[model samples]
Target: MKNFRMRVWWFLCVLPLLSACGGTEVTLGEDEDVAGMKGVVERIPAPYGAGCGIEIPVEASYLPDPGVCGNGICEDGEDMYSCMDCAVCGDGCCAGGERSWNCALDCGSVCGDHFCNGGETAATCRADCAPKLGSVLLQRVRSCRNRFPLPCNSTQTRSEFHWWDDFNVAQDKQKRTYLAQPFNPGRDGVRHLVFIIAGQQDGDMASGLTGQRDGFKDAFRDNDGSMWVGVDGQSLAYRLMAEVYRSPDDTFMGLAFDARFNYGFTPSNKQEIENAYYEWLKEKFYASNLRSIYLAGHSRGGCLAARLGRRFKQDFPQVPLILHIFDGVCHVNDHEFGTNGSGYLNPLMNMNGDWRAYSTNVGAQFPTTQNLAVYNMLSGDQVLGDFADYFVSVHAFSHASPSAVTPSFTEGDWYRQEWFTWTHNGMAHNTVSDALWHYQLSCNRFGC
Candidate 1:
C-alpha cells in the first residue's frame, strides 16, 4: 500500500509537467497556423490577442477583417472599401458623392474653361468674355496693324502709304519718289488733298506711317472719291488722284513737306527750299486743276509751312490755300523769347486762305496775330504757367510797338484761347489726332 501511495504521488507531480508539454506542442501547431493564415486573415489582429492565441483552429478563419482600401478600417466586403468609388482617384466626373472643396482633383479650378468658374475674370479669361471700353482702346494702340486695307466698292484692298518717300532720302538725285494710288479713271469731279507735316524729329514720317496714326491714315484712303481729302501725315505727299471732278482729266493735289532741312535759321536758302517744294507739287499734279490746297505743320515744321505759305500764295495766287500750324512761329532770334519775324508774320498777312494754329499758351512764344486763327491751349499746370510768365517777361521789351506785338494783331475768325487739364505733350501731340477724328466723323456724313 505504501509503495502504491509513493507511485501515485510521483504520478501526481509528473501529471502537470506532462500536461504543460502537451499544451506547448498544441500551441506550436496553433502559432504555425496563425502565421500561415496571416495573409488570408488580412493581417488583422486576433480578437483574443496574438491572433487566435490558444483558440480553436476554426476561430483563425474568424479574425478581424482589414480595410480593403488601405484606409485602416474594418468593413464588410471588398466592394464597400474599394477605391474605385473614391472621388480623389482622378475620375473626370466629380460624381463620386464628393464636393469640389472635398475633392479638387476631380474638379480642377483653371482658366480658359468654358465655364467662368475658379475665380476667372473677364481680363484673365478674355477668350470666354469681352473687356471694357478703356481696356479695348488700350489694347488697340498696343497692337500694330499689318497691311491695312482701303475700304472701297464693298471690297477690301491693301495699300501702303509712304509718308517720307518724297524727301531727298538718297544722295542720288535721279531716284525721285512718286505718289500713286488706285484711281477710278472714269470718275469725275474736283477732289481735295490734305498735307500733314510732322514735328522736328528724325523718322517722324516712319513713325507716323507705321505707328499710332495708322488708323487715321486708313480713314483717308478708304473714303469715297467724291471730294475725298488725302491726309499726308509726313512730308513728301503722293496719292492716287481720282478723276471725280467736273473735269474728268483734272487731278487735285495735297503735299506735306518734311522740313527736316529747315532746322536752324535758313533765311538765305529758305526761298530756294520753298521753290523746290513748289516745283515738286507742279511736277506731280496739274497746277491748273489745283483748286484748293491745305497746308499743315507741327512745331518748327509750322514755321517752315508759314514761310512756304507766303511763297505758295505768290506762286499760285488763284489756288485758294489754308494754313494749319501747330506750336510754330518764326522769330528774328532763335532764342525762346526772340522777336517775331516776317518769315512768320508775312505768311500770316499774305496767305489769302484760312489760317488755323494750335499751340500752348507760352505767352509771346505762341504767336497771337490778326488774320491768324490761334488755338492757345493752356496746360493749366503751375510749371507751364511759370514758364509762360517767364517767356512773356523776356519778350515784353520787344513789344513796345503794337505792330511788333502778337496780342495787337487782328484775331482770325477761329481764334480760341482755352485752358485744358491735359499735359503739355498731350496737347501738342494729340491735337491733330483729335481734329482728324472730328473731321472724319463729319466727312462721313457730309462730303469733305
Candidate 2:
C-alpha cells in the first residue's frame, strides 16, 4: 500500500511535465549529447521508402522457385559454387575455386583472415580457422546486445520471454503466442498489456542492437533498428517489451513477425500476417478481461497495429486502447497502386526518378498510392477517423492511419529529423518513442 501511494505521487509529479512538453524540451535520454552520432546520421542522405524493414530478395527471384537448389536464395547445402545467386566473394572465404586473380579481394591472404580459405586446411590454419566459441547467430547476438537491456522497470516483474509467433524457429514450432506463465495482475488489479507488431523483416523485441539477427534473412533486415526496446524502453517499460513492462505493473509483448510467408514478398505477406494478428488478439491479448491495451509498431507493423487497434476497440468497447504509429508505409498489390512487393525492394534502387508518392510504379508523376488502403484496411479511414482512444502517428516514411490526428510534413522539423535518422539508424525512433511513451504513461495514469 505504501508503494502504491508512492506510485500515485510519482504519477502526479510526472503528469505536468508530460502534458506541457514538446519535442524541443523533451529530454529523451540521461544524456542528449548524441550530436556525434546525430551529426553523422543527419549528413548521410537517408534512403526513403524501404518497405518497412524487410529487404526484398535481389530481383524477386528467391520465392518463385525456392524448391530448386539453383534458385536465388541459397537453400540447404547450397553455397556460392553451387548456386548462381549466392556469393562468398566478400564472405572472406576462398572456397569454390575463387583465387588471387578472380577474387583477389578475399584470396589475397587466407591465413589470418579468421576463415580457413583456399587450400588452407584446418590442420594448417588452426589459429585462423579454429572453431568459433559458439553459433554464428549466438555470437552476433552477443555482439549486438547494445545499450538496450530488457526495459522492464525495477518495480515490475516481467514474465519470462519466449518470442511469440516464433519467426526464427522451425515452421511446425512457429506461431505459439502465450507466456510460459500468465501475466500478473498489477496492484491495480488490471491485466493491461502492450503489444507491438514489428515492421516487415524487423522482428525480435529483445534483440538489443540493429544488426542482431535470427537467421539468414537478417542479411537485409536491421532487426532491432526500430529502437523499440532501448533507452526510452528502459525507463518506460510498458511500451516495447515485457521488457516492455512498466513499474505500475503493466507490460508489453512484441510479435517479431518475420513475415517471411509474406515475401514470398513482404507486402504480399502482410495480408496473411495481419490476419494472424487478429487471431493473436483473440488468443493472446484478449485472453482474459483486459483493462487497457496499448498498440504500436513501425512501418508495415505500425499500419497493422492501427488496424488492430480499431478491431480491439470494436470487440471490447469497454477497454481503452491507445495506438501509436511510427512512420508506417505499406506497399502491396491489393489496391491499384499497391504493386507486387516481391520486387518492391529491388526496383526502387534502380529507379531513375523519385516517387512523388509511394508506389512500386516508380517515377509515376502522380501515382495515387498514398491512400489509407495502402497501409491496411481500417474502417475509420476518413480525413479524420478515430481508430483508438488516443492515436498518434509520427509519420516520416509515410502515414499509418487515416485518423483524427492528420499527419503532415509540417509536424515540425522535429518529425523530419526523427524519421530521417530512423531511416539510417534507430536513434530518432528511440527518442520519439521515448518522449511519446512518457506522455502515454502520464495520460494513462492521470488523463493528461
Candidate 3:
C-alpha cells in the first residue's frame, strides 16, 4: 500500500512533464522535411499523386514462389526447394556439379564473409520445408541474436514462466505473469534501455539472452540494454532467433513473433498487449521514480508501436515513440479502407484509422520471393499517416551488410549504398539507434 502511494505521487510529479513536454523542436514545415539520421529533414515522397508514391508494378512475378526452386522451376510439385552453387555458398561444394535442388543443409549459415547455402532448389523444395521449417527459422533467429544484443538482448535467470495475454488483476491474475527468475547481478532499478520486438524470427523471448543478460547484470548490476523480450511471450523460447542485423545496432529488441501470427493476435491485439505492458511497467517502477518511457519497434512491431503511441497519447503524449519499420508496412485494400496507400493517391481516404503491424524485413541476400505479396500489399501504405507525424526512416541499406547487395537502388537514398561501396563494409543499422533517443532527450532537456 505504501508503494502504491509512492506511485501516485510519482505520477503527479511526472504528469506535468509528459503533458506539457514535446518531442524534438524540429519544425516540420510544409516544404521542410522530417530529418533523417543526419539531421537533414526527411524527404517523404509526396502523396502518390502529390509525387511521393512509387509506382510499383502489380505483377505476380514480384510475389514470392516459396514452393518453386532455381531459375524458376518447380517440377516436384511437392518438394521444398532452395538455390544452390553460388560462389558464396559456404558448403565448400560451390564447384560441385548437379548440386541443384539439393537440401540447403546450410542455407543461412554465415561462416565468414558470404552467406553460403540455403536457397530454394527443385528436389528439396517443399510447400513449407516440412520437418525443416522450424530448424531453418530457428537458425535464422539465432543469427540475429548473435549480432544485435545491447539494444535487444538480456541475460536474466529463468524459471517456469507464463505469458499473460491480458491482465485481470481482479482475479488475482498477475495479469501478464511471466516468471522472471531474476538476473544474477541482482541489481534493481530502472535503467536506460531499448526493446527489439522480434519478427518472424526469435520465437522465444527469454531464451536468447539468458547468458548475456547474466553477464550485464553481473557487470552493471542492471539490465542495461533495457528489457529485451519476445513478442508472443510464449514457447520454449529458444526456437526463434535471427540476427537480422548483420549490420548490428548498438543493440536490439527481439519480439519473437515467429509463431504469433499462426495464432489470432492481430493488430487489434496490440492495444491490449501495450496496455498490459504499460500497466506492468507502472506497477513495477513509477513509484521508484524511473525515467520516461520511449518505445521503438521494426516492421510489424513498428506498426504496433506507432498505434500504441497514438493510444498512449491520451495518457502520456510527451513520450517519444521511435518506430523503425524495415520492410513491414500495413496495407489495407482500397475497398476495405476506401483509400489508396500511395502518397500521391488518396490511398487512405476511406481508412478507418486502425494502423498496427509488427516489424518484418526481407534479407538482402536471403530474398523472400514468396512473401512479395505481403510487401506489395503494404507498400505505399498510409495507415500511420498522421500518427507518424515525427517518423524518420533511418539508415536503410540495399541489402544485409558485408555482402553489400542492393535490393533495388531505384528507390530510397544513395548515401548508405555509396557509403557501403566506398568502405567495403556492411553498414550498421543500429548506428542511429541512440540518435532518436538523444534527440528526444535534447528536445526536452531545455524545456521544449
Model 1 is weakest, by summed lDDT over 10 consecutive residues, at 133-142
Best candidate, lDDT: 2
- Report the candidate with higher lDDT, 1 versus 3: 1
lDDT of 3 by residue, 295-317 (tens): 34333443443334344334543
Winner by lDDT between candidate 2 and candidate 1? 2
Q: What does the lDDT read for residue 309 in candidate 1?
A: 59
TM-score (all chains, Cα) for each model: 0.34, 0.35, 0.29
Candidate 3 lands at a TM-score of 0.29
Candidate 1 local lDDT, 173-220, one digit each (tens): 111111222221221333443444544443323222112232323332
- lDDT tens string, model 2, 192-302? 655544444534433211212334233322222222111222322223322223323343233333332221244434444455556544544443545566665555555
Q: Which 10 residues in a row give candidate 3 its minimum summed lDDT?
A: 419-428
Residue 75, model 3: Cα distance from true site in angstroms: 79
